[model samples]
Target: MGDIALTTLGQDIMARLDEAARFSEPGPGVTRFFLTPEHRQVADLVRRWMEEAGLAVHMDAAGTVVGRLEGPAPDAPTLIVGSHVDTVREGGKYDGMLGVVMPIVCAQEIRRSGTALPYALEIVAFGDEEGARFPTTLIGSRALSGLFDPATLDLADRAGVTLGQAFADFGLDPAGIPALKRDPEKTLGYVEVHIEQGPVLEAEDLPVGVVTAITGIERHTVAFTGKASHAGTTPMETRRDALAGAAQAIAAVERIARETDDLVGTVGSILMEPNVINVIPARCELGVELRSPERGIRETARRTVLESCEEIARARGLGFEHTLGYEEDGAACSPRIVAALKEAVEADGYRPRELFSGAGHDGLAMSALTDIGMLFVRCRDGLSHHPDEHIAEEDADAGARVLLSFLTRFGTPRP
Candidate 1:
């Protein structure tokens, strides 16, 4: 691609990203949740763009915005490409937005070139990959993959509104959710373009790379209970402090993660009863997350952390309880799809690096239904889920070109 074309495409992607940011919570940064007004507005905007690109578009009952371009044959298999559109609290603009926008841009280019593939192209802007509103992630993709359970419809948000109610309020029928599942026999595969969201790509001096796998994730909420007492009167040796037990568990998680290879554990959130300075905490609740590309190692790390927490609770004479919030196994990309992406990257004059995604993505959920692939665009300092996350324009263009190249060559008959 020439500099002019690349520049134009980059500018367009950035413009659309900025436009999406406008629908966020009324604050200094972006925050769009599932079934919220901001999410609906952004979905509408993306739907319009898909329409402008000659795609047949609709918002599914799960709130996923889907745009389809029919192949030459009516019953041909479909190739799905997309990423989530929802953002975390005070999120960056490009994390999920770029994946949705770039695919549309590629579709436009395909149309301009008058090229038709053997399979239909469907671009999806998923509604809830972040799970920022509800406790569950991948709600949209799960529905499309036929994994959505009716019971999940009763999941409540901070406002105590049921997910089913939100669906109704958004003009969608929860009863019709099953109709949204795609037929596996008619689907070829799925592809997602997302920011690297880590330092590996930038450190390697590469603009784009092919993902080998997405890390498995296990989330837990752990609570330690003990008697509250006066902070000044309670002696260190005599006190049973829940916060102290939780603090020890947190430190153990950090230690275990560092000692284990390819494993990571985080205690991202915590709450304590009797948070006042003059009182010993009676209860402490913490959010524990464990991740790794290898499922065995990930599970082992999770067990190790739980055991450590148990040990701490026992030593401190506190009651311990934990509940699993979410668990997803690591997903490997299809080797066939990875080869095609690598060829496209090399064709564009960039050496391809294979890396595992540390952060979770909608692709993790889609993998249950189809062979999935991912292309990672380098981001500045590997920052994501924050207001400061950044990606260079040229890097964005490179990702777009590689995706277009892959789409152009995929599933074509070998001459």
Candidate 2:
């Protein structure tokens, strides 16, 4: 097949993405999560696609759907390509699903042409990258990476269902997750194609770019406690308003993040008790998240924000508390994989642009298992995690073609 095949391939992959979007919950946009009916339906669809590509397919203990293309040697090391299948609330059609569908089409093309690969090829679609249901993220990838902390299974969701019970309800044994871990020695590498989720590529007039590194992320749940009283009865000088203290702390978070280079902080979720015009708020709870490519910069910003929050609480005579929810350190892309992707982009008639990723990805978890690489396709308006997320059809074609080029040339010595 020549370059013309890529356009047809992109159309095929886009249709599959649209089909997968149908399984989402009854909402404004896609709202699928792990261990739910939507997950089951999408898993079945993915299974059929992989099967059509002439690959053996299976769903792992953590609900990760895996497709395998055996090479000449059964025991030979394998090249892994995949991304998460889960989506956040009101998510778009191409966040995680795009990465999965494009590879399936490439696998289909590989099989159709009878191309020979030196190593076995495996395509995976992780079940829970969004963690929209479980309050935890990267369950499937972390489990496969052998870095899963089993205690996460004990954590509960909004409906109070634990991850372990949900696994059981879906007919999967949580005990088997440990067995799903891949051996580092026999694994060649992992490659993922995803949306840029930023405007750099579009601003530069590029369809795709190579990833240099992913930003590390840390999140904390903070709460402030104070006395509850009637707003009319509580005087401004005597009232210990928890909400007021929380508001001050939120501003501090923003200020600190801006002061530190490349550091971003946000307080997206917030709650207050007796949230009415006539009553003084007695408690306030919020989620504070911070991210940066450099761990030292992220850590320093986190320390400053935490201290300032506590100080504000003390001044307002409100009790303060916080708990660390999740953290994943930043990781650099493999040099070998980056070089191969760069060449692949050039081979496909596009200039390769390398940039640091401000967003987190499944590759962060996979880094613990084997080498990792990423190809970022331009998205419309740099929007993600919303219903408006989009990418051009030609851009999708570019991403898939580059991925195919990278796969065919990788795992061999380059001239």
Candidate 3:
């Protein structure tokens, strides 16, 4: 098999992507979260694909599916390729699914091309990358990285169902979580192919983005409290409007983020207590997410934002409180993986640009414990997490080819 064979593999991978896209709402967008029926259905489909590719398969108690091409030496380290299959609310068809399917396509191509690799190849499709239902992130990758703990199992969704319950409902055993942790010593490296979910590649007219670092994320839930009073009765000077104080704090967060080159802060969600039209808000709750490639910048911006909010609350005679939410440490790709991607891109005749992710991912979690790398494909109009999010089929296919080439080089170990 040669370059033409790779084009055939690309077409096959895209066909699978389209099939998965059809499983959910086709045009409007796809929505599949962890432990949901859609999630299970997709997982089953991926497993069948793995079987067709002639790989041994298994799903850990945490619901991560692994398809293994045994290495000649069973004890030798393994090269793992995977990304989550779950989608965010009204998410695009390609975001996480590309990462999941690309490895399978590559595995099939490797088998056909008779490429020999030094290490074993394991294709994985993680369960929950979106965390749309649980309000937590990277559940599947965290389990593999040994970062998951009892507390994680006890975490409840918005519906008040524990993660254990969700696992149980999905026909997985929650008590066997200890077995889910992958031994870092047995792992060679990890690679993932995913849509950029941003506009960097499109803006640069590049088809592929080799990730430099996964941005650090800091999440905070802030609450502002004040006396609830009639809007008309509260005098302009004496009134302690919680919403007013929150607005000022939100503005401060934006200012701090804009002060740095890579820092970004967003107050995307907010709620006003006792939301009566004529009443001054008694309390206001807002969620702030700050991200930066540099940890120092992230910490500094978060601290500055918190301090500014406190000051605003004190001056305005309101009570201010904030609690730290989820955090993902930034990860820089392994030099070996980066170089390989560069070679693969050039070999495939596509220009490559170094990029950083503003959002967190399963790869970020895996990066904590092992050598992990990521690739980003372009998204249409830079939109994501919305029904209108999209990616061109040709671009998606291009990403798969680059990924398949990288995986072919990594080659699976025969068990």
Please give each candidate's TM-score. 0.86, 0.84, 0.86
Q: Would you give me the overall lDDT of model 3?
A: 0.83
lDDT of each: 0.90, 0.90, 0.83
- Cα lDDT tens digits, model 3, 222-286, are 99999888888778898889998999988898888788788889999999988898998899999
- TM-score rank, highest first? 1, 3, 2
Clashing pairs in 2: none
Candidate 1 local lDDT, 1-415, one digit each (tens): 2333555777778778888889999776788888999988999999998998899999888888999999999999999999999999998999899999999989988997899888999999999999888877798888888888889888899999988899899998978878888888999999999999999999999999999889988999999999899989889888889998999999999999999988889999999998989999999999999999899998888888989999999989999999999887999999989998998999999998998899889888788899999999999999999999989988888888899899999998757
Error of 3 at 380 (Å): 0.9
Clash counts per candidate, in order, are: 0, 0, 11
- Misplaced by over 4 Å in model 3 are 1-7, 25-28, 135-137, 151-162, 223-242, 273-284, 311-319, 410-415
Models sorted by lDDT, best on top: 1, 2, 3
Tell me each candidate's RMSD, in Å, in order.
Answer: 3.4, 3.7, 3.9
